[model samples]
Target chain A: MTYWDQEKECMARDNLEKLQLRRLKETVFRSYAFVPAYRAKMDAAGIKPDDVNTLGDLQKLPFTTKQEMRDNYPFGLFAVPMSEVVRIHASSGTTGKPSVVGYTRKDVDTWADLMARALVSAGADKRSVIQVAYGYGLFTGGLGAHYGAERLGASVIPASGGNTQRQILLMQDFGSTHLACTPSYALFIAEVMHDMGIDPAGLKLKAGIFGAEPWSEQMRTEIENKLYIKAYDIYGLSEIMGPGVAIECPFRTGLHIAEDNFLVEIIDPVTEEVLPEGSLGELVITTLTKEAIPMIRYRTRDMTTLSNGECPCGRTHVRMQKVLGRSDDMLIVRGVNVFPSAIETVLLGIPGVEPHYMIILERQDNLDIMEVQVEVSEDIFSDEVRKLEDLHKRIAKELESNLLISVKVRLVEPKSIPRSEGKAVRVKDNRKI
Target chain B: MAKQISVFLENSSGRLAHVTRVLGDAGINIRALSIADTSDFGILRLIVNDPDHAYKILKDAGFTVSETEVIAVRMPDSPGGLADVLDQISEENINIEYLYAFLGFAGGDALVIFKVEDIKKAREVFEKKNINYVEAQDLYKL
Candidate 1:
């Protein structure tokens, strides 16, 4: 029932926008002065930091794309020197090269504050025992949740990911009350609990914070029912400093962006024009206080609309609808973003596989399943069954390792997949989303 | 050395009929058939007159098809007839992958198709036991 930062969370709309304007000007000035990419973009657009005076003039800045992040690569976009930056994380993608981000010591503190605010908003408190199940290392979900739980004064269990059996055991033994991980993984944990004959009621779990993937409302209901916990959706991207950008309050209508730290805008993805309020379009964000890697109008490509409704929970920041889908052909399978081009790159790297391939996405038991169907060269098909099966397993294993999702690799006959005359259709998403 | 056509099918409505329709349009007559299904997919096995042609046509129609050699054995149309042949094959350590019954002479005798690990070994076992066996060409005519 308590708010982490009540003043900021429930500020008046005018006051909130004023604070945002101040931070926006400072962030733009820093990005333009320190980061060459932002400088070049502003130069091209003939815009200056003072030009972004009111939030209305934010449209004049050029948009930043994912390709620009890739073009900058490792440390090209950092606003601070490496010595001042304390930690780094990167977005997972199919390009083999990731979009790297850095966080200074103060930036890390700000991230923890926002995450704590998110947790407290979702009804987590100091007494709650948090179990972080997101993968650790380069991915931000694990460490992001860990720091927030620590800052909230909760007993943190840094149970990174995998080892579901042990995770269940710890959940019971540690008296874990909060779970932090992807929604699909939460379902998988529930399945493992059922397999182990453990009842959700027997555990002391009270709530769960699930993110790092786009999950449906039906999935949230399933997780809540199976895990006997109030499942809340958390949204973030590595480019925007990972999973605590926005989260659903207890009311659960939509996610409330941490507007004090990041500014949000909805723009027409194609025409590069900002859409009106409450209309669905691609999301763009400008980092307000991030000094390490401040991004100016970074295009998220995630499609969602904005809501300024006053929440019953009293948070006055704008709420964003849960992301519907990407403007591009990025498929999220079991919490991992899989690009058809990434699959194609891996497939083309291996021998005996044709360039032709199809990615089939299906939903089975409220979980996402991705199957890669690739054509096998005639010579490979003519080989013995054992050899062919080995190849199949090999491709599946390789893809699973690279994509971080279990993939079922099917080898079809050569030239069997229907070839299109223009723009090969590589993905067939059968999910009702 | 009888040939059995096996088609992979998704467990959905109209999929089986679609396969049969494709075969029917191609002038391929199915003599005997059975389907083995799981929750996700099914494998349709058929004893057709021309397996190579049927396989080609089914493949061309966008269905996954494969051919396997099966031996046809004539057994008494009564209890323990199948058990007798299975006992013999089991004694010889010849694994029977699958088997199905087919009509023959309307009650005089019944033809049982057996797909085994080793077709030659199965034929030799049937020959040693003096069990009646139908040749592939004669079975096709029937």
Candidate 2:
């Protein structure tokens, strides 16, 4: 358990807060002074850099959002000149225009150091061979993990996303010890390995850092069992700092955030007010050390809670639970709020239900109807129609009792659900309204 | 005990066509077929010349196929032929889950497939009542 930066990682809580405050003030002042878009926003809200004397004053600043990023488009909120910006990454922007994020030379270095700390916490060392399977180029996952693994002095194989067979071959031939990719992609890779007849035990893969999509703990167990590796949940977005914002330690406990670099707050998404510690709500982050684009209180839309205590790993940073689901992913069906992850938890516990599912929402008679189409795998399929119907009823019954909402369970053909190379599409809203 | 191939099919178009194409390509002839469908999916019950072969090919083609035991009976080809056969079974208190028509091996007679609640007991009643039913091997040769 050698720390990447033992002094910074294990600093006292009071000292870390002091460091965060200093960086917060500098980031506030720089954003107000260099970026006019942020300055106008602050002026409209009656907030000045000089007024942010304490950390709690962070709530006074207007929150930046994903929609604001797209409105700014490209680089409207960059706090530094283009000469200092050395790297750029944009989210896939499943909606319309991609939200762009820039990294200055110093910001990129800070990102690499933060990612290295995350990797170290998740049990990586200079001797480890890390295979970064995340997509490179405009997507932050690939290059983010690449630089972090390199910073940790570990051997990095830049095996970007999508060549599943070749990735498996390289993972075996290169003696890769760690894999970095989305959890859904990792599951698909495991499926490919099964088809390729490549035994996971025959490979040197040890642990996996999976993020970029919300997944359940049962999903983690499936990946761990399928790949024969420890699956660590990582939390990050390009709006924040890609795949290294926070990650679970080797103990598989809550994810530890680098408090010195990022300030985390859980806020009620509806009221937009910060909640007390350990309350699950939408995550809002204020980057304290980023140089290229100093985001002030960015509403991440991810739902999770923060807990403060000394981790067994000896780090004092606050830990966030594995994200429940994005507020944007929550579906309101028939007046009952439902999280797709809740449906996933139910599906995972039942037999004959594969992890592949698609939630189709429709409006009939001006009422919301949620139909969960579950893939029928070879194991769950039966020639007996009654048996198959019973499985379908079981899923629907369990979902309604568990989620307290009436759900329609549809048994789909085996492998009928479509999966993208990136995040798997879990929901499809077909309501014209 | 006769083997009938039961395949799970989605109600989406072309799936049934695909299954039939796969079985036809394998040189398996459909002797008798019945489809039980819902709004979302269907169960295509098939009585074929080669039940084992049809099941294997459909399974390989990625269709969820299964084999179940059903009784094939040779009844009179009159208007009341089905009623007479079903009346005797009802008299013995045997519950028939479902029954479908099938092509007969010979002319002037009708072949019926019976999926009942109690198959072994049905066989006993059939034997005691002097009913004519095709043997499992004889039915597969149709």
Candidate 3:
């Protein structure tokens, strides 16, 4: 229950806001002065560094987006000289170009501290043995957790993802107390553990910090029960920092942002207007203390809400609920908005069905069709065809009821869908658009 | 009690050809084959020369395969010949899950394959009615 930095974590609201305003002014000034991209963006918007005296002036500043990062390409948006930049990480864009992010030495330290705060908020301490299964390199997950665990003075096992059996062997041999990885990988680890005839309760594991992909309460319960550990949600993006932007404390209510380092805002994605607190909208963040690449009002595209309520854990930062889904990931089928995560929540709630699924959207005779290919258990597949068809109809009916859009459901054999060690790709849009 | 190999396949181009290529390369002959398809996927039912070998080869080739028991009845090639057998089975209250036909000769009696809910009951009914059922080895020879 020990705080990593009690003074900064539990700072008074008035003091914290004053600090945020000061950091915001400095960040805006630095971005306008150094980086040409932000400079032009602000200049076009008729904004000056001196104009940002109050925190509300942030809305007047231009917002940086992922497309802007791509247009800038590698190192185009970095504010500092290459010499001062200590490290660089790029997201796996998988489409065109990766969005590169640079970090100075001081920036790295700030990132580690925020991650450390995140780990401690989830109940990890100096004595905790952390197994960082998140993939290292280019991706921020592995290295991010690694630095944070070291900052927390914990013994870190940089497992670096994949090789589940070996991971389990290490988890058992090293008596690891904490796990860091995507929630899907945690379930995979549990699956391998059962195959190895290893009981989860026999392990010294207690808490799991899972993120990097959207997961549901049903999945959290599944991971907790399977691994016999308390699963905590951690949130971050490579564009901002890494795995420590915000995280859920033991209260398990919402993720607490590192308000001192990063300023968070919610905005209507379509209108691009800032929304009131407690309203779900696209997440927008401005790096308050970032030195290498000062992101001025970067649009995160993650849909969520901000609640400034005082947490039972005593942190003064506003808490963001678990992200509902990314606005970019929303699929408009037959003019009806649907999210793959929403379908996942429904599919996971049903019995005899695996959590693996793929949503295929296609155009047929000018009509939009969505097919949900879900993988059921082997037992279900082996059942009578009538029973299998019954399961299929049941899933489709449930989905139509929840999504308000009829969808075709196909029951495929177990393992028919491809599995990923990282974020699961949920949608395949075959429309020419 | 004749064994039939059933494979799950998506209704995509060259999918059935892929399954056939695997079995043909394994030196297994398809004695009789029928495909039941839905809008999305298809089930390829095959009475092969070696059911176990065909199942292994199809499965090893990453196809969803299972061996099922189906009765192959020898019937007259006349129009009512197949109908008579189906009518007798239906009268005995046994449901036919699926059925397919093969030529006994160029223009002679036909070999009809039937997958029923209860293979044992179907056999009892066939025996009581003196319906000639093809054995797995004998059918392979044919």
- Model 3: docking quality category: incorrect
Q: Which segments of model 3 are wrong by more than 4 Å?
A: B1-142
lDDT of 1 by residue, B9-51 (tens): 6556888999999999989998888777645455688888888
Candidate 2 colliding pairs: none
Error of 3 at A23 (Å): 1.0
Position A308, candidate 3: lDDT: 98
How close is each model in CA RMSD to the real structure?
Answer: 15.3, 3.3, 5.1
Displacement of the residue A342 alpha carbon in candidate 1, Å: 22
Poorest 10 consecutive residues of model 2 chain A by lDDT?
Answer: A376-385
lDDT of 3 at A403: 98
lDDT for model 2 comes to: 0.88
lDDT of 1 at A135: 86
Interface RMSD of 2: 2.0
Model 1 spans with C-alpha error above 4 angstroms: A330-433, B1-40, B43-142
Off by over 4 Å in 2: B1-4, B47-56, B66-102, B106-140
Q: Quick one: best lDDT, which candidate? A: 2
Report every candidate's CA lDDT.
0.83, 0.88, 0.88
**Ranking according to lDDT, highest score first:** 2, 3, 1
DockQ of each: 0.05, 0.36, 0.14
Q: Is candidate 1 or candidate 2 better by TM-score?
A: 2
| B1-142 per-residue lDDT for model 3 (tens digits) | 6888887777678988888989889999888888877776667888888898888787667676777888889988887998899889998999988888763442366898888999999999999998878887887667
